[model samples]
Target: MTQTDRTDTAERPDPPESSESVATGGAAQAQSQFRRAWTRFRRNKLALASFVVLVALIILAVIAPLIAPYGFEEPDYEHTLAGPGTAGHLLGTDLLGRDLLSRLIYSLRTSFLVGFGAELAALIVAVVIGLIAGYRGGRAEQFLMAITDVMFAFPTYLFAVLMVAVLGRSVGAVILAIAIASWVNMARLTRAQTMTLMQRDFVEAARAMGAPGVTIAVRYVLPNAVGPLLVAVSFGIPAAITAEAGLALLGLGVQPPTPSLGGMIQDGISYVTSYPNMLVWPAVMLAVVLLAFTWLGDGIRDAFDTTGTRR
Candidate 1:
């Protein structure tokens, strides 16, 4: 070979990496991001405690049927309104003689159902609308955002009340109502994230390569935007749970014998002076759920933050 040819060959860079290597690298990067976020989350004592508590509560709710001393509706008419530690009723019995502890366990299951179900529904609607509005960016964006703005004007609780009233009171109705009322925040956050991601070089490259809008959105934009979206969802869940509780308090949530936290609170209100434990137990459980979710959400948001600011 010519001396000049040998020199040019040495100057050339290594060939582009194979597709398998690229995929593996992407996976590793994602794993690293997860580890960093987890590390940050673990460092926050309140958040770590909340995670453990939340997981334990979920487990308790799941196995409630096995552990509960009595059926939620099964009454011990002999011990009606009995205080805590009465015979088989550890936490006492309601006016109907139903075990308070058993009802509380079932109520927790109901709350979790509403929280996760509503959040899942809200995520679907929010992500779809946000992606279309931000990625398309035209009259479509203007129209969709206009609707979102109108939704924002209504008070969330009032809107949820109206929906539940219209749909009729039930678990399914409560889930749908809370989802409709709560999706606006997620949609707005998602839109902002998608808009920012669209300006990225990778997105531009995908577009230049003739990728369809859907392909670019799913393959490039959505994955990049997921971190912020998850943070939004973590925050959104507690709101959904609270909304359900409020609706139940107002007699528009899960119906009688269903044993929702709010319903228990409503029932307990009548006996507040006579037997405060009835009111206190459900209220305490609700407070724990709310605080756990709020603190955990704060931790997740902080962990995902790239700004390196500790709260």
Candidate 2:
């Protein structure tokens, strides 16, 4: 009952309540969390409305080329600044006589394009640098954090404008500018979350179990950190959009006759007193985008809170 009994016990498989079970149970718990969150989210009237509005805007942007009645570039001077419900143009024309509705559709697409592209670029850089900064610590952390500090010190709008100016006022430029400007925030967030998550017992357990550093960070630390990261991304999209618009407003974004929202506002501002509608529509659209994103972000934040159901 000594050596032989010890050997047999050691050879026995892990118990049913071991790590594998924990994984399975954790997955189920995650699913349950998602269901609960969704149930709560759906009950939020403002959030639901905002979600619907965002979906509709996305759909419109996607189908713009096919459904736009008139080419955004095509202009009818006779209809310039015409009030809504004109002969042919529903929303009227801009200073260049371009179709307002069509231009707006394109602008929405461009805004979303820049937002998503910038976030993607930032995400790539942030994930790598952030994980390294958090996991490696010491000099690596110091260097990376120092760089982030420098980025933070620079004015966000000015930095974006300068980058876009260097790159030129195109869609790619806008995306590149915002990405470069915005990545610091994401990197900081990632580093903080990673540092926190890396200290968890599960992460230590993974390390004890001989999991590689990258594996532990990617598989365990990152997944848990993704919730807040996702919230950051949700918030980041609107910020990017606003940045793009601001750049365009300064005549530093998409070239004229292209129907960018910022450009439209710029044009409409001159005639705001005479043609309030010109500024009105674009302003409303921008407001809607801002509000929708805010609500969605709030809803997501509430869902992921884990503290309570109220948002």
Candidate 3:
């Protein structure tokens, strides 16, 4: 066939009578990529373990209320400060006689909520900004990168603290603050990936096929460029969780009558001299959860590296 025929073929919409071969091939490619990625990820036993633990943590957080022996706010004055296993309060009680286990579970839920919610917001903003900046290059790219640079210059936690403090320390506010603070990394990641992918022959082919700018960016460039952003998302979650925990620890997060891992830890610190378990469990959980997120992110990065270095 002639070049014109090939270009027409590339740009032509499939007729209603067309077979499913094209769709099937695309599905097969996607499935193959996923299968390969999963294989690479599984080869890193620690990352696989981390992913499993992370899922378990999310499940545990979801079921916390149903499984807890008592309400998070229910006071057991008689059993106040009770050590582990007292009256089936497995993790013990805090100074207020609240079951530590119940509070811990609920607090965990809050932390994870902040993590996932904030990361989602950040990713949305990042993807949009990155797509515009990278695909549109020249003046648009320069302007967008300038803004991203300004955002990066500010300390992320400090920005979050300022935002949450101004907006009041609610869950939504915290998520918003973290999003504003953390989207820079994702934006930069996506932009770099887009720039790299835009130079490839497939992108040039799409451009030469009379594709509109937005269509090419969205359908061809964005999807292909998301690999780096996927890794960024994995890392961003932990950053968000830590940011929320820090705010809570400093007494700027979820107020009293509400349980959050950081707030609970702050409360536990007062009694840490006498009751170490109060401070220990949440701290351990935070560490383990963050470690899991980091491991999983690393695994995903390696899996999608495209360098064929993954074993």
Model 2, span 1-311: residue lDDT tens: 79999999999998644454444443455457667778877888888888899999999998999999888788787776677778688887767677788888988988888888999899989999999999999999999999989999999889998988789887888899999999998899999998987766666666666778888777777777777888899899998888878887788977766766777788789999988878888888998998999999898787778876554
Model 3: what TM-score? Answer: 0.87
Compared with the true structure, what per-residue lDDT tens digits does model 1 show for residues 46-133? 9889989999999999999999988999999999999989987889999999999999999999999999999999999999999999
All candidates' TM-scores?
0.91, 0.88, 0.87
Weakest 10 consecutive residues, lDDT, candidate 3? 17-26
Better structure of 1 and 2 per TM-score = 1
Order of candidate numbers by TM-score, starting with the best:
1, 2, 3
Task: State the local distance difference test value for candidate 1.
Answer: 0.88
Best by TM-score: 1
lDDT value, candidate 2, whole model: 0.83
Measured with C-alpha atoms, the lDDT of residue 41 in candidate 3 is 81
> Which run of 10 residues does model 2 get worst, by summed lDDT?
18-27
Q: How many Å off is the CA of 29 in candidate 3? A: 6.2
* lDDT string, candidate 3, 183-268, tens digits: 99889988888888778665666666666889767776776666677888999899888888889888888767778888888888
